[model samples]
Target: MKIALTTSGENLEAPLDRRFGRAARFLLYDLKNRTFELIDNAQNLNAAQGAGIQAAETIVRAGADAVVSGHCGPKAFRVLQAAGVAIYNCEAATIAEALELLKDGKLQPAAAADVEGHW
Candidate 1:
């Protein structure tokens, strides 16, 4: 599965960014292949509006099967849902720990957006 994790750096050890839309970066990790790619989200960091929507589009374009973040907003949640991508909430300190939770089947899919837009 391709899991997109909100992060502040390029590697798995990077701290997880709590805000999905404004996250500094996204780590696209392939669970089966055990490989990863880093996506720059600097463009959306300062977006006056529609950051969530744009971020969601970026994830979709990156072919993420799921997203693991501290929180997801309504707009992003809807876009992801429409694309058949699952959203998971993880408060793990690092991206690596979040990956572990996913591998251990401890992370659960989010049923709805957890925070308001611009959060």
Candidate 2:
């Protein structure tokens, strides 16, 4: 399965970015292939509105099966849900740790948006 993790850096060791929509980058990891791709999110970092929606679109376009992030806003949540991409909230310190928690089934799918949209 492919998982997209919101992060501040390009590698697995990077600290998890708590803000999903304005995250510095997204590390898309393919578990089966053990490969990863880093996608920069600079464009959305300073977006006045709709950052979450744009971020959700990015994840969908990247073909991610799930998204691991600290929080999900209403607009983003709906977008991801509509696209069939599961959203999991994690407080893990690092991207790699979050992946482990997911692998161990410790991470649970979010039931609803955890944060209000900025717009």
Name the top TM-score candidate.
1
Model 2 lDDT tens row, 14-119: 9999888999889999999999999888999889999999999998999999999999999999999999999999999999999999999999999999888872
* TM-score of each model, in listed order: 0.98, 0.97
lDDT of 1 by residue, 59-117 (tens): 99999999999999999999999999999999999999999999999999999999998
State the displacement of the C-alpha of residue 3, model 1, in Å, after optimal TM-score superposition.
0.5
Tell me the lDDT of candidate 2.
Answer: 0.94
Worst 10 residues of 1 by lDDT: 110-119
lDDT of candidates 1 onward, in order:
0.94, 0.94
Off by over 4 Å in 1: none
Assess candidate 1 and give its TM-score to the true structure. Answer: 0.98
Clashes of each: 0, 0
